[model samples]
Target: MKDPANPTSRTPEDDRLRRRIGPTIRDVARMANVSIGTVSKALNNNGSLKAETRERVIAVANALGFRPNSLAQSLHRRHSFTVGLISNDSFGRFTMPIAEGLEACLADRQIAVFMCNATDDPERERQHVEQLLGKRVDGMVITARRADRRPGLDGALRGLPVIYVFSQSDDPEAVCLLPDDEGGARMAVEHLIGLGRQRIAHITGPERFEAVRLRRDGYRQALTAAGLAEGEGYYLSGDWSEKWGYDAAARLFAHGREPPDALFCGNDQIARGAADALRERGIAVPEDVAIVGFDNWNVMTEASRPPLTSVDLNLRALGREAGRRLIAMIDGTPMRGVSRLPCTLVIRESCGAKTDTLTGTEDYA
Candidate 1:
């Protein structure tokens, strides 16, 4: 057979080697003087190869240090087959689910991912961005702790596909995916209203958080939509902790006015705390005051006296969509502007969804 490497000569076999599925496997097979099938069997333990032949192929592969040159391969296919994910959220609850969704899709495409957590530090974020860029990731997905934009993110990922999750991006042309906090909050409040709770109150996280304000707006909107007068202790803002929920409920009772018949909390932690306060005062949950919370953090909700009802942000779906969008962008399909995902109300005992009556025996069925 004529040599494949002969100058000024080209063959279909040679051209195939030069394509995105490149030369390493073929080179090893040729040097070992064996069929590619045999080489594959030896490497993957799939079938069988003669001892001497397998040893020779192993030595050849080891000597060559066979690893596909992604740059050269990508030049042929115009795809790096790699994506980057950057997260500023230290909590695994948010970022991990997103990562899992991204990974599940990418794996089907045989693409790899580079994941980095900035840990909410600016310097760390800068360093991680530089490293990911240096590694030539084809696209990037960023998930942040806040719903607001992050600086330098657009510039760092310029000329490459980028998706923002759980946050908005400063670049108006960038695609950002965020939960509809207002819609979620309104859903919680409306649920309490539907359950025959007239006096509804709300408690949430720090005032500085944009989510806090949106959720507050949602709570108020639901009340207005229902034509129900706002409760005496209409709103309270504090740290997003169980203690905050407890103190807020306590303060509501302390005002020497009407205690809420229902409460909508910003997050599950607050909801759990408020439930604790109600229980400590010999008040039965749902029977006395039905409660609904945001974020639907299962751990916190399940642990509550009567499991808390909360709003699910559909974070996993957000992540799956983010992955799909970035992949599309990488393939030259453009998507810009912020896309908000709606929240679903998850029913549990806290809001009296699984029971007989709000003011009767606590029949769970």
Candidate 2:
């Protein structure tokens, strides 16, 4: 029998069924002593309302276990509240961090992200874009493994907001977010210069890459700023690999010429390879020759003997900024031009500096 004072009380089975059904917006409106529209406004964070009233509605909703129907809310707002992320990073090295950062930024706003990998295939990318467009995603983010300029999407997005992360777009009006390769390289070299290393050599990837060219320019600029001559044989350009680094280091020490006091490698793998080659030659790191690398890749940096001081591109931060800018564009704000985010120097034992010291900051512009 039901208790007279508690008419809603029911058996355990009935309570279980009620729990399954859950509470609705109407329940929240009734419990909060407000109209259904007021509850909708509070829950959806739409329309101006008294702060006290909003708080009360929220509290009552929480107590009643009320959850709004996302489909209904989206229909009312005319926004899918979803974003599409497209990438060509098959290895997940760059895409993963960017996606994580993008998700972190969008989650707070109750927006969802759909990730699609193009794997260097243009047809596949077009298909993904079309599918996302069909789903009516609010915006899209395009990324790539390398920070190179890529062609714009093939489809007519009807003025849909699109952001390029870790990639550049040929369109002058397209928003592109990239790591400041030149600035980062300059910072790395400046750090080595501050250590009083007079003779510095650069070992890097092929000249075809924009990153390689920018980093090379930065290295040269830093050296020139210090009144140091960039020696004829100081720059070695090759494929980005440990083998190239090892061979390049050997060449630097070849021809009975004076060896450099420091080496700035384009990537951590190369730096590790150079360190190994130096080890075989009985040259002590920092004491004899210091080294710095880009990418700050943990697998190579942490594993290297004496570790490695490296430049971190801050990819995650770039992604977060990309998300913010995309949302702004979606909200009718215009964003254009290229924005270069700063890089950080993660100091370890390799450069003879105090271990685990982090430094460097550049404005996003």
- Give all candidates' CA lDDT scores: 0.82, 0.90
| CA deviation > 4 Å runs, candidate 2 | 1-69, 356-361
Give the per-residue lDDT of model 2 (tens digit) for 255-337. Answer: 57999999999999899999989999998998999999999888899899988999998888888898899889989998888
lDDT of 2 at 233: 92
For all predicted structures, in order, the TM-scores are 0.80, 0.83
- Indicate the worst ten consecutive residues by lDDT in candidate 1: 356-365
Off by over 4 Å in 1: 1-27, 31-72, 355-365
lDDT per residue, candidate 1, 1-365, as tens digits?
45667776867876876664544888988888888778877775557667887788888888877765577667666777998898888877788877888888778778888999999888898898888887778899989767776674887666888889987777787788888888788777877888799899888899888899989998999899999988655788999899999999888766468788888999999999999888888888889889988887889978888988888877887888888888888889978888787777888888888733121111111
The C-alpha RMSD in Å for every predicted model, in order, reads 9.6, 5.8
